[model samples]
Target: MKTRVRSADFLGVVVKYMVLFIAVFVVLFPLYISAINSLKSNSAINNLSPLQAPSHLDWHNYVTAWVGGDLGSAFFNTFFIIILAVLGNVILGTMVAFALTRFDFALKKYIMGAYLLVIFIPTMTVQVAIFGVIKDLGLFDTRFAMILLYLGTNVVQIYIYMQFIRRIPMSLDESAMLDGASYFRIYRSIIFPLLAPATATVAILQTIAIYNDLYSPYLYMPSSNLGVASTALLRFQGPYSDQWNLIMAASLIIAIPVVVIYLILQRYIFAGIVAGSVRE
Candidate 1:
């Protein structure tokens, strides 16, 4: 009976590993194909199956994609937009969250309710109205418009920060107050430092969202000179759609920064999420 039980447990472990192996393959197979094909020439890609490795490494695909796609300007524009938008979201979200969680004011409940309501309402439902407002304000083709939009649309970040802030003991704030520290001083010295994990989580999320956002930048900043990586990738299509190798290479280039960032801050992301969720 003990032998049979041990056999059953061993079978379960084997089955679990098999399932994980299959899942990993399913997720990674496409990326492997892309990476391999990105090093091949157009002719090689046409003749060979993507599942097969390239005959020889052709580094020219990256060069052609970079030069033809004008990726330098695209990357610059995208990075500029991402930095501004993330900064705005982090700062504004932290302030609003701090105010909501730590202070008492008139209509505070109503204000929190409004933010909750905004989250439920899909942004697509009000996109046309937002577009009209941007047009009227003459911000339709500017980077500032994107920054402002990101700042105002950070409800999730604010909510995350507020949850994390609530988990912090209010006694710290009381002690700081007793020491004659101003509100800003307490925030700068105590609250902000403690909220580092949450801030890292917010920055990672906002960075990915803003970086991958194709529609907003395409719609608002349609000028070729102001094109972002997503929109510039479109240039690799149309007329050159057959250049799959170049397209794949460009995609890999664009993805590098996001991958690096996630690797750096991934530890904080899980901790921040768990802390925020387990608290009030």
Candidate 2:
């Protein structure tokens, strides 16, 4: 009976792993095909099946995509936007979270309630209004506008931080206060260090979000040459048609940063989110 049960359990494990492998392959198969095809010469790609290995590697597509996409300037713009946006979220988010969690204020509940309400409201519904404000502020075609827009739209991150902060011990703040530290000092010196894990998670998530963002750049900064990698993919698709290999190459480049980030930080991401979400 024991041998029979063990056999059944082992079979179930094998079945589960097989199903998971199939699911992953199903999702990644197209991306793999694209990557393989991107390395083939145009003629080779036309002749060979996408699943087949490239007969001759054509690295020129990467060069062409980079030059045609004007990816250098776009990459610089994206780097700054992503960095600034992450910085804004971490700093302001920490502060907001600290206040809501550590300090007691009369309007705190009202403010928290407002944030909760606003969280569910879709920003797309206010596109026209947002554009008008952007124009009025004379930031219609500037990277600064995108930065500001990112800042405003990231309140959810602050709320996440706030939830996490509530889990931290109040005694730490009390000890800091007893030692003649100000609120800002306590935050900077004590709390911020401990929140590194959460901040890292937020940075990784926000970086991906801001980097891949295309619509805001398109709508707000259409005349600006500071397009992000995501928007630059459009150049591969002409009015007449699209170049599949070039598009794939450009897309693969655009995807590299996000993939690298996830691979590097994924070890901590879920733990941080869970810890932040359930903080006492």
Candidate 3:
């Protein structure tokens, strides 16, 4: 009986490590190939195995990609858009969440039902209509168009805020009301400040999503001056399509921001998720 238990534990340990190793390889392998290919010339890449490192460091590919793609402006554009999207989503989501969870209203259940309904519908199906609306609004080919699209609060943010707000005690709200504090005052002064963890998690997530979004930036903002990092990569495609080294370097360059962001704030993400999962 003891031997059986020991064997089962050993097997579980082995399986867990195996799965972990495979997951690590799945993520790191492509990044490794991209890094190696980005360092070599087109000729060197064609001749050598992707797993092998370049014989000599070639910094020229990065320089070419940066100049040809106008990555500085693209990065700036992406950064600006992400900041606006994160702020808009967080503020609006927080307010709506506070209203739904705290106050009793006539249309409350219907409003919640609507949010649930929209999440199941895919965004791609509505793009044709969305595009027409943007044109009608005169927001086409501008950063504001992308900002407006992303600015809307989504189901995920609403749920996260609700979860955090639920955990906050109602006693604090009642005490503040006794002092003639308005609902807005109680929310702004007490509730919002206490939601720092949830706010951090939401901001990081929304920032990363907006930063990495290629579709909105590509479709809505077509002007060269408005090109984001993902769209700017298109410049390498028309004439420099054969320049795989430049393409690889450009791809890796654009991915750097989100990677750094995830690494830095990843702790908050886990904390928020775990904390939000439990309710009193």
TM agreement with the true structure for every prediction: 0.93, 0.92, 0.89
> lDDT per residue, candidate 1, 113-225, as tens digits?
89888887876677778898889989999988788887776568887898888989999999999999999998889999999878888887778878888777888888877
- Please report, in order, the local distance difference test score of every candidate based on alpha carbons: 0.84, 0.81, 0.83
> What digit string (tens of lDDT, one per residue) describes model 3 on residues 38-109?
999878988888788999878789998888888889888887888887788888989988999999999999
Please count the clashing residue pairs in each candidate, in the order shown: 0, 0, 0
Instruction: Give the higher-lDDT candidate: 1 or 2.
Output: 1
> What is the Å distance of residue 70 in model 2 from its true position?
0.9
lDDT of 1 at 224: 78
Q: Is candidate 1 or candidate 3 better by lDDT?
A: 1
What lDDT score goes with residue 95 in model 1?
Answer: 87
Off by over 4 Å in 3: 1-12, 271-280
What TM-score number comes out for model 3? 0.89
After aligning candidate 1 to the native by TM-score, how far in Å is the CA of 58 from where it should be?
0.3
Write the residue-wise lDDT of candidate 2 on 45-135 in tens digits. Answer: 7888778979778999899888888878789888988888889888988988888888789999998888776667767677778999999
Clashes of 2: 0
Q: After superposition, how far is residue 279 of candidate 3 from its true place, in Å?
A: 12
Estimate candidate 3's alpha-carbon lDDT, on a 0 to 1 scale.
Answer: 0.83
